[model samples]
Target chain A: MSQWLTLFQKELLEMWRNFKWIWVPITFILLGVQEPLSSHFMPQIINSLGGLPDGAVIKIPPPSAQEVLIKGLSQYTSIGVLIIVLTTMGLLSGERKSGVAAMILVKPVSYESYVTSKWVGAMLLMWGSFLIGYLATWYYTGILFKWVPISDFFASYFYYGLWLTLALTVTISLSAMFLTSGMAGFLSLAIVILMNVVTSSLSNWMEWSPAQITTYANKLLLTGKIPDSLFPSSLLALVCTIIFLLVGIFVFKRKELASS
Target chain B: MITINWGLLAPIIIIQLILLVVALIDLVKIEKTNGPKWLWAIIIIVVNIIGPVLYFVIGRRNH
Candidate 1:
């Protein structure tokens, strides 16, 4: 356990030096703030465009606070996820490439702990930054629009957080398998996008899909009701996350580091 | 042009400026990057939020 903690602390220090600690949260906050501010000033922005006819009346109904919050989430679903994948692309691949993995494994550290420590470190940065950004978005939504109930805020946060966990897990596993960080990052992104697209297209049969986590989160935010499949979907996501972690460990053990 | 609320929008601007500043500092301090350092400096300064993020993500080559 102490060994794992040491490895985890090392992972964090590396992230801090890489500026992941700074850019990730700040980018998320920027995306969060952009959503509400743009929505709040939508009418003014449209008028400023200067393309409308003289005395043209564009009647865009003011979006509800829930809707604005949902929009903020979409920003996360796209740009936020992109940033995350890019930032953590080098998680395992970089270590292996730069010969750091060989040096670490030469010590008394367990392979399982090493992989788990990386996952945990990435998860900490991801979840911490996301929570801070989401709260900022929620606060802006309340001030500019209506206040979202705290219960719904938390409920949606939990579900979305699960989805992000799944994304990070996929990246970690891929990072372990691929030698190149760019390949791992892009392949994981492709899988994530494909999962979302497939689930949406086959929504009738894909009720228990891990990709449904985002849809369920959106539902919770828009309507204060839980989907019946929420538990199953969350369970499946958790299972997948664990499975990916094990796969990462297995691969990391088998593959000889370039340094070795 | 509805009267712009600088007070309400100040935080976003401040956060963006911080991103710009951080990216610039890193660029100056780092020994090597994936591409030309000058190009990164231009992207960081000119490209808004995305520029700095791009510089951080793909610009700096980890040695």
Candidate 2:
């Protein structure tokens, strides 16, 4: 127990040293604030482009607060996801590559605790930054647009957070499986992208897919209603996260850490 | 020519500045980066939000 606490603290100290704590949340806040700001200024921005004929009446209807919030969140699916995957991609692979994993494992630390501490530390960083960023976006959306229902906002926040959790877990597990951080990052991203592709192309049958959480989150934002499959889908995602954690621990336990 | 509510936009600008400053400080202080330090400093400054993030992600070699 104490060992896990010490290891977790080390993970956090490492993150602090690398400036992960500083840049990551700043990036999230930046990302969060952009959507509402852009949506709020769309008409003027269009007019300033100056390509239209004289006296052109651009008739873009003002987006609803819900739509603005949803659009803001859409940025997360792309740039936000990429940032998360990039941030987490090196969790295990980098340690192993630098021979730090061997140094740590040589001690009395349990493999499960070591891997779990890393996962927990990464989770803290991701969730903390995400919450700060999401709140920044929410605050901006409220200021520039109508206030969304607090119930709906919280619901969508957890659902989107779960999606991020799943992405981070997959990246960590894959990092455990690979020696090269690049390969781990690439494959984890490919897997996430493939899941979105498959889920979209087969939405009819993918009701229980974790990727559908975003769709469900959008639904909550738009209609403020929970779908029937939300629980099952969330459960499945949770299970997948656990399975990935187990796989990561299993792989880490067996894999050779010293690369040189 | 587009007018922005600076009060509303100031936070985002400040957030970006924080990221830039932190990345620059790290670049200057770190012993060895994955690539040239000057190149990273340029990237951290010139590329807006993504440059600093890229520097953090791939620039500083993990010791």
Candidate 3:
């Protein structure tokens, strides 16, 4: 137990040293604020920059507050995931390459403690940042637009978080499996994007797919109701997260952590 | 002087400045990076939200 605590502390300190503790949340806060602020000011912005001829009153229909919040989640799916992938893609591979992993492993550290501590630490960073961003977006949306029902917001938030954690787990596991940070990043990025693309394009065939959580999230916010329950998707994503952690532990045990 | 809606826009500017400053500070303090320090400084300064993020993600030499 104490060993795990020690490893967790090291991970936390490493996060601080890398500036992830500060920048990750800041990034989320910025992303959260950007959506509502831009949506609220879109008309003024276009009028000033649209460069239209005089007297042309282009009456663009204003999007509902629900739409604005949903748009924010979609932004998170893209930019948020990219930032996360880039930030964590090197978590394992980089440590191994830098000889840090070997140094720790040589000193009576078990693979379970090492891998689990990392997963827990990474989870703290992701969830902490996500909550801050989501709350900011929610508050801004309420102030500028309208507040969606709290029940719906919480529901969607849970599902979206599941999807996010699943993606992050995949990233860490891939980094553990791969030899280089670039490969881990590229593979995870491709998978994240590809998952979204496939799920959107073939949603009819995959009613229970995990990507359904993202769609369900948007709808839950927009209509204050979930068109379909997200139980299956949420469960699947949770199971996948657990599997990824296990795989990471196995890989760390079997593979040689480069110490060059 | 043109009137500006500082109320709505000031937050964005403030947030951006904070990110820039923090990124710059980390850059200065870190011993080594993936590339030249000057390049990263320019990137963090020149680019908007993404610049500092890019540096943190790709620039730092974790080893």
Candidate 4:
């Protein structure tokens, strides 16, 4: 237990030393803040462009506060997915690429402990950042609209964020297991986008496909209408996440680190 | 304050069991390498469903 804690602390400290917080939090906050701010102000901005000489007849309807909040949340959701994928892609792969794994292997830590600690630390940090961003957006959106229910709004955002985090973690684990550092990071992004595209394409045929999980969760949160189909999709995602992480760890433990 | 879905949980458990079986097969086949097969096996088994990822990231040989 002490060893696990020590490893966790070491990994987290290393992450902090690398200044990941700066880029990650900045990007998250920017997305969070932009979502509400833009949604609140877009109508005015559109009206300002109404002075077109050619008379484009741009009748910009004022978005309701709920519409604004939802728009902001959707924007945040997309950006959040990107940030999680990029940050996690190199969690393990980077250590191997920099020869840090060799040094760590020489320590008293077992391979399992070391890898588990890193995974836990990364998940905590990633999930923590996401929660922070969600809260920030929720608070600001509530302040802007003054009519949005904070509890319901936050509940919906939280579930959506949770699902996104789980999906990205699986992608990261797969990337780390299969590719080198540069390739791992790129492949993580590719895999995520590909999953989205493939699942969406199959959504017509597969009634309970993973592609609709995020959308369904968001709808449930927003409207308080949980579809029976989402239960299966979410279950599938959870199962896939566990499988991917296990496969990654299994492959990593026996990999030829001498060449890595 | 989220509602738990047992029906959703069922499929996840099934998927995990399937993954575990697949991982065990891989571990058995790869036991003859330079490293301690038992240690690798334990790592894969103990890490539960995530063990395979660690194996892939740091365990397997290129050849």
True A-B contacts kept by model 4? 0.00
Q: Which 10-residue window in model 2 chain A sums to the lowest lDDT?
A: A148-157
Q: CA lDDT, every prediction?
A: 0.90, 0.90, 0.84, 0.65
Worst 10 residues of 3 chain B by lDDT: B1-10
Off by over 4 Å in 4: A47-50, A53-57, B1-63
Ranking by lDDT: 1, 2, 3, 4
Candidate 2: segments with Cα more than 4 A from true spot: none
Q: Residue-wise lDDT of candidate 4 within A29-147, one digit each (tens)?
A: 55665666666666666666565667566666666656666665665556667656656666677677667777888787687777778778777776676666666666666666655
Worst 10 residues of 3 chain A by lDDT: A220-229
Q: At residue A235, give the lDDT of candidate 2.
A: 91
TM-score of each: 0.97, 0.97, 0.94, 0.72
Compared with the true structure, what per-residue lDDT tens digits does model 3 show for residues B4-62?
67876687688789989999999999899989999999999999988999898888865
Q: Put down candidate 1 lDDT per residue, A52-76, tens digits, no spaces.
A: 9888788899999998999998888
lDDT of 3 at A164: 88
Interface RMSD of each: 1.1, 1.6, 2.8, 17.0
Q: What does candidate 2's lDDT look like per residue over A190-236, in tens digits?
A: 99999999999999999999999999889878987788888889999
The worst-scoring run of ten residues by lDDT in candidate 1 chain B lies at B1-10
- Residues B10-59 of candidate 4: C-alpha lDDT, one tens digit per residue: 54355455555555666676535337778777877788544644454345
DockQ, all candidates in order: 0.77, 0.81, 0.57, 0.02
Question: What TM-score does candidate 4 get on C-alpha atoms?
Answer: 0.72
